[model samples]
Target: MSKITNLLAGLGGAIALNVIHESLKKKSKETPRVDLLGEEALQKTVEYFGGEIEDEKTLYKATLAGDILSNAMYYSMIGNGAPQHLWLRAISYGVAAGVGAITLPEPLGLDPEPVAKTKTSQALTVGYYVAGALVTAGILRAVARKKE
Candidate 1:
Protein backbone atom coordinates (compact mmCIF):
# COMPACT_ATOMS: atom_id res chain seq x y z
CA MET A 1 0.00 0.00 0.00
CA SER A 2 2.78 2.42 0.88
CA LYS A 3 4.66 1.69 -2.35
CA ILE A 4 1.50 2.30 -4.34
CA THR A 5 0.88 5.55 -2.52
CA ASN A 6 4.43 6.75 -3.16
CA LEU A 7 4.12 5.94 -6.85
CA LEU A 8 0.92 7.91 -7.10
CA ALA A 9 2.46 10.89 -5.28
CA GLY A 10 5.47 10.95 -7.57
CA LEU A 11 3.28 10.82 -10.63
CA GLY A 12 1.13 13.62 -9.29
CA GLY A 13 4.16 15.79 -8.62
CA ALA A 14 5.50 15.30 -12.13
CA ILE A 15 2.15 16.11 -13.69
CA ALA A 16 1.75 19.22 -11.54
CA LEU A 17 5.20 20.46 -12.43
CA ASN A 18 4.56 19.93 -16.14
CA VAL A 19 1.26 21.75 -15.96
CA ILE A 20 2.77 24.74 -14.16
CA HIS A 21 5.63 24.91 -16.65
CA GLU A 22 3.31 24.81 -19.62
CA SER A 23 1.07 27.46 -18.09
CA LEU A 24 4.01 29.77 -17.50
CA LYS A 25 5.20 29.29 -21.07
CA LYS A 26 1.75 30.10 -22.40
CA LYS A 27 1.57 33.23 -20.26
CA SER A 28 4.96 34.36 -21.44
CA LYS A 29 3.88 33.95 -25.03
CA GLU A 30 0.87 36.12 -24.36
CA THR A 31 2.95 38.93 -22.88
CA PRO A 32 2.89 42.13 -24.87
CA ARG A 33 6.02 42.79 -26.82
CA VAL A 34 8.10 45.58 -25.34
CA ASP A 35 10.49 47.24 -27.71
CA LEU A 36 12.86 48.46 -25.07
CA LEU A 37 15.42 48.90 -27.82
CA GLY A 38 14.35 51.21 -30.57
CA GLU A 39 14.70 50.50 -34.27
CA GLU A 40 18.23 51.83 -34.26
CA ALA A 41 19.20 49.32 -31.53
CA LEU A 42 17.70 46.48 -33.50
CA GLN A 43 19.52 47.61 -36.63
CA LYS A 44 22.75 47.50 -34.64
CA THR A 45 22.04 43.90 -33.63
CA VAL A 46 21.26 42.96 -37.22
CA GLU A 47 24.49 44.52 -38.40
CA TYR A 48 26.46 42.79 -35.67
CA PHE A 49 24.93 39.46 -36.56
CA GLY A 50 25.66 40.08 -40.23
CA GLY A 51 21.99 39.81 -41.12
CA GLU A 52 19.56 42.25 -42.63
CA ILE A 53 15.96 42.69 -41.55
CA GLU A 54 14.59 41.30 -44.73
CA ASP A 55 11.22 39.79 -43.92
CA GLU A 56 8.78 39.08 -41.12
CA LYS A 57 9.48 35.35 -41.36
CA THR A 58 13.09 35.76 -40.28
CA LEU A 59 12.13 38.04 -37.42
CA TYR A 60 9.46 35.63 -36.29
CA LYS A 61 11.88 32.73 -36.29
CA ALA A 62 14.38 34.67 -34.19
CA THR A 63 11.67 35.61 -31.74
CA LEU A 64 10.49 32.00 -31.48
CA ALA A 65 14.00 30.70 -30.86
CA GLY A 66 14.51 33.22 -28.07
CA ASP A 67 11.23 32.22 -26.46
CA ILE A 68 12.01 28.51 -26.67
CA LEU A 69 15.43 28.99 -25.09
CA SER A 70 13.98 31.07 -22.32
CA ASN A 71 11.29 28.50 -21.68
CA ALA A 72 13.82 25.67 -21.65
CA MET A 73 15.95 27.42 -19.08
CA TYR A 74 13.03 28.29 -16.88
CA TYR A 75 11.60 24.80 -17.03
CA SER A 76 14.94 23.17 -16.39
CA MET A 77 15.43 25.26 -13.29
CA ILE A 78 12.03 24.87 -11.67
CA GLY A 79 10.73 21.60 -13.10
CA ASN A 80 11.57 17.99 -12.32
CA GLY A 81 14.96 18.22 -14.02
CA ALA A 82 16.51 20.05 -11.09
CA PRO A 83 18.05 18.35 -8.07
CA GLN A 84 16.02 20.50 -5.71
CA HIS A 85 12.74 19.31 -7.20
CA LEU A 86 13.89 15.71 -7.02
CA TRP A 87 14.92 16.06 -3.41
CA LEU A 88 11.59 17.60 -2.59
CA ARG A 89 9.69 14.81 -4.28
CA ALA A 90 11.88 12.25 -2.64
CA ILE A 91 11.19 13.77 0.76
CA SER A 92 7.49 13.63 0.09
CA TYR A 93 7.72 9.99 -0.88
CA GLY A 94 9.93 9.27 2.11
CA VAL A 95 7.42 10.79 4.47
CA ALA A 96 4.60 8.79 2.95
CA ALA A 97 6.60 5.59 3.21
CA GLY A 98 7.55 6.44 6.79
CA VAL A 99 3.92 6.94 7.73
CA GLY A 100 2.91 3.67 6.18
CA ALA A 101 5.76 1.82 7.79
CA ILE A 102 4.70 3.07 11.17
CA THR A 103 0.93 2.90 10.86
CA LEU A 104 0.53 -0.32 8.92
CA PRO A 105 1.74 -3.58 10.24
CA GLU A 106 4.28 -5.30 8.03
CA PRO A 107 3.66 -8.96 7.53
CA LEU A 108 7.25 -9.58 6.51
CA GLY A 109 8.52 -7.50 9.40
CA LEU A 110 10.69 -5.55 7.02
CA ASP A 111 12.77 -2.62 8.22
CA PRO A 112 12.34 0.87 6.81
CA GLU A 113 16.05 1.42 6.47
CA PRO A 114 16.08 0.33 2.84
CA VAL A 115 13.07 2.49 2.09
CA ALA A 116 14.80 5.51 3.64
CA LYS A 117 17.67 5.28 1.16
CA THR A 118 16.04 7.74 -1.18
CA LYS A 119 19.19 9.32 -2.52
CA THR A 120 19.66 6.72 -5.23
CA SER A 121 16.04 6.91 -6.29
CA GLN A 122 16.20 10.69 -6.30
CA ALA A 123 19.36 10.69 -8.39
CA LEU A 124 17.85 8.33 -10.95
CA THR A 125 14.66 10.34 -11.21
CA VAL A 126 16.61 13.58 -11.62
CA GLY A 127 18.90 12.08 -14.21
CA TYR A 128 15.99 10.92 -16.33
CA TYR A 129 14.25 14.28 -15.98
CA VAL A 130 17.35 16.18 -17.06
CA ALA A 131 17.91 13.89 -20.01
CA GLY A 132 14.31 14.30 -21.17
CA ALA A 133 14.53 18.08 -20.79
CA LEU A 134 17.72 18.23 -22.84
CA VAL A 135 16.18 16.12 -25.56
CA THR A 136 13.04 18.23 -25.67
CA ALA A 137 15.07 21.46 -25.73
CA GLY A 138 17.12 20.15 -28.59
CA ILE A 139 14.00 19.22 -30.52
CA LEU A 140 12.46 22.61 -29.91
CA ARG A 141 15.59 24.40 -31.06
CA ALA A 142 15.75 22.32 -34.20
CA VAL A 143 12.10 22.93 -34.95
CA ALA A 144 12.51 26.65 -34.39
CA ARG A 145 15.44 26.76 -36.74
CA LYS A 146 13.59 24.74 -39.32
CA LYS A 147 10.64 27.05 -39.09
CA GLU A 148 13.01 29.89 -39.87
Candidate 2:
Protein backbone atom coordinates (compact mmCIF):
# COMPACT_ATOMS: atom_id res chain seq x y z
CA MET A 1 0.00 0.00 0.00
CA SER A 2 1.10 3.54 -0.64
CA LYS A 3 1.67 5.83 2.32
CA ILE A 4 -1.70 7.52 1.85
CA THR A 5 -3.44 4.19 1.53
CA ASN A 6 -1.69 3.02 4.65
CA LEU A 7 -2.82 6.11 6.49
CA LEU A 8 -6.39 5.69 5.27
CA ALA A 9 -6.27 2.09 6.40
CA GLY A 10 -5.34 3.19 9.85
CA LEU A 11 -8.15 5.70 9.94
CA GLY A 12 -10.53 3.05 8.72
CA GLY A 13 -9.45 0.74 11.51
CA ALA A 14 -9.93 3.50 14.04
CA ILE A 15 -13.41 4.28 12.81
CA ALA A 16 -14.39 0.61 12.84
CA LEU A 17 -13.05 0.08 16.32
CA ASN A 18 -14.75 3.12 17.78
CA VAL A 19 -18.07 2.32 16.19
CA ILE A 20 -18.07 -1.28 17.38
CA HIS A 21 -16.69 -0.55 20.79
CA GLU A 22 -19.25 2.15 21.45
CA SER A 23 -22.05 0.01 20.15
CA LEU A 24 -21.11 -3.00 22.24
CA LYS A 25 -20.81 -0.84 25.31
CA LYS A 26 -24.28 0.49 24.73
CA LYS A 27 -25.87 -2.83 23.88
CA SER A 28 -24.24 -5.18 26.33
CA LYS A 29 -25.15 -5.24 29.97
CA GLU A 30 -22.82 -8.14 30.56
CA THR A 31 -20.92 -8.03 33.83
CA PRO A 32 -17.48 -6.89 32.73
CA ARG A 33 -18.47 -4.01 30.53
CA VAL A 34 -15.79 -1.73 29.17
CA ASP A 35 -17.29 1.71 29.23
CA LEU A 36 -14.17 3.84 28.98
CA LEU A 37 -10.77 2.57 27.97
CA GLY A 38 -9.77 5.99 26.71
CA GLU A 39 -11.06 7.82 29.71
CA GLU A 40 -9.41 5.41 32.08
CA ALA A 41 -6.18 5.51 30.16
CA LEU A 42 -6.13 9.27 30.22
CA GLN A 43 -6.98 9.43 33.89
CA LYS A 44 -4.44 6.81 34.85
CA THR A 45 -1.77 8.31 32.61
CA VAL A 46 -2.20 11.74 34.12
CA GLU A 47 -2.17 10.38 37.62
CA TYR A 48 0.85 8.22 36.92
CA PHE A 49 2.68 11.29 35.72
CA GLY A 50 1.49 13.22 38.77
CA GLY A 51 -0.71 15.58 36.79
CA GLU A 52 -4.15 16.79 37.72
CA ILE A 53 -7.06 17.39 35.39
CA GLU A 54 -8.56 20.84 35.91
CA ASP A 55 -12.13 19.76 35.44
CA GLU A 56 -14.53 17.11 34.19
CA LYS A 57 -15.06 18.64 30.74
CA THR A 58 -11.36 18.83 30.15
CA LEU A 59 -10.96 15.29 31.35
CA TYR A 60 -13.75 14.09 29.11
CA LYS A 61 -12.27 15.72 26.04
CA ALA A 62 -8.85 14.44 26.89
CA THR A 63 -10.26 10.95 27.28
CA LEU A 64 -11.89 11.05 23.85
CA ALA A 65 -8.69 12.32 22.31
CA GLY A 66 -6.73 9.57 23.96
CA ASP A 67 -9.15 6.96 22.65
CA ILE A 68 -8.91 8.27 19.10
CA LEU A 69 -5.15 8.44 19.23
CA SER A 70 -4.87 4.92 20.61
CA ASN A 71 -7.11 3.44 17.93
CA ALA A 72 -5.10 5.16 15.21
CA MET A 73 -1.83 3.91 16.61
CA TYR A 74 -3.07 0.38 17.19
CA TYR A 75 -4.74 -0.05 13.78
CA SER A 76 -1.73 1.44 12.10
CA MET A 77 0.48 -1.01 13.91
CA ILE A 78 -1.56 -3.94 12.66
CA GLY A 79 -2.06 -2.63 9.12
CA ASN A 80 1.53 -1.59 8.56
CA GLY A 81 2.85 -5.17 8.42
CA ALA A 82 0.98 -7.55 10.68
CA PRO A 83 -0.24 -11.01 9.68
CA GLN A 84 -3.31 -11.50 7.53
CA HIS A 85 -5.27 -13.61 10.03
CA LEU A 86 -7.86 -11.20 11.32
CA TRP A 87 -9.02 -13.51 14.10
CA LEU A 88 -5.51 -13.99 15.35
CA ARG A 89 -4.82 -10.29 15.14
CA ALA A 90 -8.01 -9.56 17.00
CA ILE A 91 -7.10 -12.00 19.77
CA SER A 92 -3.68 -10.50 20.13
CA TYR A 93 -5.03 -6.98 20.21
CA GLY A 94 -7.67 -7.95 22.71
CA VAL A 95 -5.18 -9.63 25.00
CA ALA A 96 -2.68 -6.81 24.97
CA ALA A 97 -5.28 -4.07 25.37
CA GLY A 98 -7.30 -6.14 27.77
CA VAL A 99 -4.40 -6.68 30.10
CA GLY A 100 -3.56 -3.02 30.09
CA ALA A 101 -7.21 -2.12 30.56
CA ILE A 102 -7.54 -4.17 33.72
CA THR A 103 -4.14 -3.76 35.26
CA LEU A 104 -3.03 -0.20 34.64
CA PRO A 105 -5.71 1.72 36.45
CA GLU A 106 -5.43 0.59 40.04
CA PRO A 107 -1.66 0.71 40.14
CA LEU A 108 -1.92 4.29 39.02
CA GLY A 109 -4.66 4.88 41.62
CA LEU A 110 -7.23 5.77 39.04
CA ASP A 111 -9.79 3.15 40.05
CA PRO A 112 -10.59 0.98 43.00
CA GLU A 113 -10.25 -2.18 40.93
CA PRO A 114 -10.23 -3.52 37.41
CA VAL A 115 -13.37 -2.64 35.48
CA ALA A 116 -14.37 -6.26 34.96
CA LYS A 117 -16.17 -7.64 37.95
CA THR A 118 -16.50 -11.33 36.97
CA LYS A 119 -15.32 -14.00 34.56
CA THR A 120 -18.03 -13.51 31.96
CA SER A 121 -17.57 -9.78 32.12
CA GLN A 122 -13.87 -10.24 31.67
CA ALA A 123 -14.36 -12.43 28.59
CA LEU A 124 -16.87 -10.03 27.10
CA THR A 125 -14.56 -7.16 27.90
CA VAL A 126 -11.81 -8.72 25.83
CA GLY A 127 -14.35 -9.81 23.24
CA TYR A 128 -15.26 -6.19 22.53
CA TYR A 129 -11.71 -5.38 21.59
CA VAL A 130 -11.60 -8.44 19.40
CA ALA A 131 -14.84 -7.34 17.81
CA GLY A 132 -13.31 -3.97 17.06
CA ALA A 133 -10.39 -5.61 15.36
CA LEU A 134 -12.77 -7.80 13.40
CA VAL A 135 -14.62 -4.71 12.30
CA THR A 136 -11.41 -3.08 11.18
CA ALA A 137 -10.36 -6.13 9.23
CA GLY A 138 -13.80 -6.47 7.68
CA ILE A 139 -13.82 -2.87 6.55
CA LEU A 140 -10.36 -3.16 5.06
CA ARG A 141 -11.29 -6.35 3.29
CA ALA A 142 -14.51 -4.91 1.94
CA VAL A 143 -12.75 -1.88 0.57
CA ALA A 144 -10.11 -4.05 -1.04
CA ARG A 145 -12.78 -6.20 -2.67
CA LYS A 146 -14.61 -3.14 -3.90
CA LYS A 147 -11.41 -1.89 -5.49
CA GLU A 148 -11.06 -5.16 -7.35
Candidate 3:
Protein backbone atom coordinates (compact mmCIF):
# COMPACT_ATOMS: atom_id res chain seq x y z
CA MET A 1 0.00 0.00 0.00
CA SER A 2 1.00 3.59 -0.52
CA LYS A 3 2.12 5.73 2.42
CA ILE A 4 -0.93 7.92 2.12
CA THR A 5 -3.17 4.85 2.15
CA ASN A 6 -1.46 3.56 5.25
CA LEU A 7 -1.89 6.83 7.06
CA LEU A 8 -5.51 7.08 6.01
CA ALA A 9 -6.13 3.52 7.15
CA GLY A 10 -4.49 4.35 10.44
CA LEU A 11 -6.70 7.38 10.88
CA GLY A 12 -9.78 5.39 9.97
CA GLY A 13 -8.82 2.69 12.44
CA ALA A 14 -8.20 5.24 15.16
CA ILE A 15 -11.52 6.92 14.57
CA ALA A 16 -13.29 3.57 14.49
CA LEU A 17 -11.73 2.40 17.72
CA ASN A 18 -12.50 5.64 19.50
CA VAL A 19 -16.06 5.69 18.28
CA ILE A 20 -16.67 2.09 19.25
CA HIS A 21 -15.00 2.31 22.63
CA GLU A 22 -16.52 5.64 23.60
CA SER A 23 -19.99 4.75 22.36
CA LEU A 24 -20.00 1.73 24.59
CA LYS A 25 -18.63 3.73 27.48
CA LYS A 26 -21.40 6.29 27.07
CA LYS A 27 -24.05 3.65 27.46
CA SER A 28 -22.49 2.50 30.71
CA LYS A 29 -21.69 5.78 32.45
CA GLU A 30 -23.25 9.14 33.11
CA THR A 31 -19.95 11.01 32.95
CA PRO A 32 -18.41 12.23 29.72
CA ARG A 33 -16.57 9.43 27.88
CA VAL A 34 -13.90 11.63 26.31
CA ASP A 35 -13.15 13.05 29.73
CA LEU A 36 -12.61 9.56 31.11
CA LEU A 37 -10.16 8.26 28.49
CA GLY A 38 -8.68 11.71 27.94
CA GLU A 39 -8.01 12.11 31.65
CA GLU A 40 -6.32 8.76 31.70
CA ALA A 41 -4.13 9.72 28.76
CA LEU A 42 -3.45 13.14 30.22
CA GLN A 43 -2.41 11.75 33.59
CA LYS A 44 -0.13 9.20 32.01
CA THR A 45 1.32 11.62 29.47
CA VAL A 46 1.94 14.37 31.99
CA GLU A 47 3.56 12.10 34.57
CA TYR A 48 5.78 10.52 31.95
CA PHE A 49 6.80 13.91 30.51
CA GLY A 50 6.44 15.94 33.76
CA GLY A 51 3.39 18.18 33.66
CA GLU A 52 -0.23 18.49 34.81
CA ILE A 53 -3.68 17.74 33.39
CA GLU A 54 -4.41 21.46 32.79
CA ASP A 55 -7.92 21.07 31.44
CA GLU A 56 -10.43 18.73 29.80
CA LYS A 57 -9.44 20.06 26.41
CA THR A 58 -5.82 19.24 27.09
CA LEU A 59 -6.79 15.79 28.18
CA TYR A 60 -8.86 15.19 25.07
CA LYS A 61 -6.08 16.35 22.81
CA ALA A 62 -3.55 14.21 24.60
CA THR A 63 -5.87 11.26 24.36
CA LEU A 64 -6.36 11.85 20.65
CA ALA A 65 -2.63 12.01 20.07
CA GLY A 66 -2.16 8.72 21.85
CA ASP A 67 -4.99 7.15 19.94
CA ILE A 68 -3.44 8.21 16.65
CA LEU A 69 -0.15 6.66 17.66
CA SER A 70 -1.76 3.41 18.71
CA ASN A 71 -3.76 3.09 15.52
CA ALA A 72 -0.74 3.97 13.46
CA MET A 73 1.13 1.17 15.13
CA TYR A 74 -1.53 -1.33 14.15
CA TYR A 75 -2.07 -0.09 10.61
CA SER A 76 1.64 0.28 10.06
CA MET A 77 2.02 -3.45 10.26
CA ILE A 78 -0.56 -3.94 7.56
CA GLY A 79 0.94 -1.14 5.57
CA ASN A 80 4.20 -3.03 5.57
CA GLY A 81 2.44 -6.23 4.53
CA ALA A 82 2.39 -8.00 7.85
CA PRO A 83 -0.57 -10.15 6.84
CA GLN A 84 -2.88 -10.33 3.88
CA HIS A 85 -5.37 -12.50 5.70
CA LEU A 86 -8.05 -10.30 7.17
CA TRP A 87 -8.72 -12.49 10.21
CA LEU A 88 -5.04 -12.85 10.92
CA ARG A 89 -4.54 -9.11 10.70
CA ALA A 90 -7.49 -8.63 12.95
CA ILE A 91 -6.11 -11.12 15.45
CA SER A 92 -2.76 -9.43 15.48
CA TYR A 93 -4.26 -5.99 15.93
CA GLY A 94 -6.66 -7.25 18.57
CA VAL A 95 -3.84 -8.89 20.49
CA ALA A 96 -1.93 -5.64 20.52
CA ALA A 97 -4.97 -3.73 21.72
CA GLY A 98 -5.87 -6.42 24.24
CA VAL A 99 -2.46 -6.27 25.84
CA GLY A 100 -2.79 -2.54 26.19
CA ALA A 101 -6.34 -2.84 27.46
CA ILE A 102 -5.42 -5.26 30.22
CA THR A 103 -2.27 -3.56 31.38
CA LEU A 104 -2.48 0.19 30.77
CA PRO A 105 -5.81 1.12 32.34
CA GLU A 106 -4.84 0.38 35.93
CA PRO A 107 -1.61 2.36 35.85
CA LEU A 108 -3.47 5.26 34.28
CA GLY A 109 -6.17 4.93 36.97
CA LEU A 110 -8.82 4.29 34.36
CA ASP A 111 -9.89 0.98 35.85
CA PRO A 112 -9.18 -1.62 38.47
CA GLU A 113 -6.61 -4.36 38.10
CA PRO A 114 -7.40 -7.02 35.51
CA VAL A 115 -8.35 -9.60 38.09
CA ALA A 116 -10.44 -7.07 39.95
CA LYS A 117 -12.26 -5.91 36.85
CA THR A 118 -15.62 -7.41 36.07
CA LYS A 119 -15.94 -9.94 33.28
CA THR A 120 -18.36 -7.71 31.44
CA SER A 121 -15.86 -4.89 31.33
CA GLN A 122 -13.09 -7.18 30.17
CA ALA A 123 -15.23 -8.74 27.47
CA LEU A 124 -16.52 -5.45 26.20
CA THR A 125 -13.11 -3.83 25.99
CA VAL A 126 -11.68 -6.79 24.15
CA GLY A 127 -14.64 -6.98 21.82
CA TYR A 128 -14.30 -3.34 20.96
CA TYR A 129 -10.62 -3.70 20.19
CA VAL A 130 -11.13 -6.68 17.92
CA ALA A 131 -14.10 -5.08 16.28
CA GLY A 132 -12.15 -1.95 15.64
CA ALA A 133 -9.34 -3.93 14.06
CA LEU A 134 -11.77 -5.83 11.89
CA VAL A 135 -13.29 -2.57 10.83
CA THR A 136 -9.92 -1.20 9.82
CA ALA A 137 -8.87 -4.31 8.00
CA GLY A 138 -12.13 -4.49 6.14
CA ILE A 139 -12.03 -0.88 5.13
CA LEU A 140 -8.44 -1.12 3.98
CA ARG A 141 -9.21 -4.18 1.88
CA ALA A 142 -12.19 -2.48 0.35
CA VAL A 143 -10.16 0.54 -0.51
CA ALA A 144 -7.45 -1.61 -2.03
CA ARG A 145 -9.99 -3.37 -4.20
CA LYS A 146 -11.41 -0.09 -5.36
CA LYS A 147 -7.95 1.02 -6.45
CA GLU A 148 -7.48 -2.11 -8.56
Q: Indicate which candidate wins on TM-score.
A: 3
RMSD to the hidden true structure, all candidates: 21.2, 3.4, 3.6
| Candidate 3 to truth, TM | 0.75
lDDT, residue 74, model 3: 72
Return the lDDT, model 2, position 62. 73
Question: Highest lDDT, which number?
Answer: 3
Clashing pairs in 1: none
> Candidate 1 — what's its lDDT?
0.38
Higher-TM-score candidate of 2 and 3? 3
Worst 10-residue stretch by lDDT in candidate 1?
31-40
Ranking by TM-score: 3, 2, 1
lDDT of 3: 0.65
Sorting all predicted structures by lDDT, with the top scorer first, yields: 3, 2, 1
List clash counts for every candidate, in order.
0, 1, 0
Q: Global lDDT of each model?
A: 0.38, 0.61, 0.65
lDDT of 1 by residue, 1-148 (tens): 1233333333443433334333443243332121211222344567789977766666655644443443344333322344335445444433443244333323434332322235443333333334334443333334435666
How well is each residue in 77-124 modelled by candidate 3, as lDDT tens digits? 555564457658766777667567666767756644322256666666
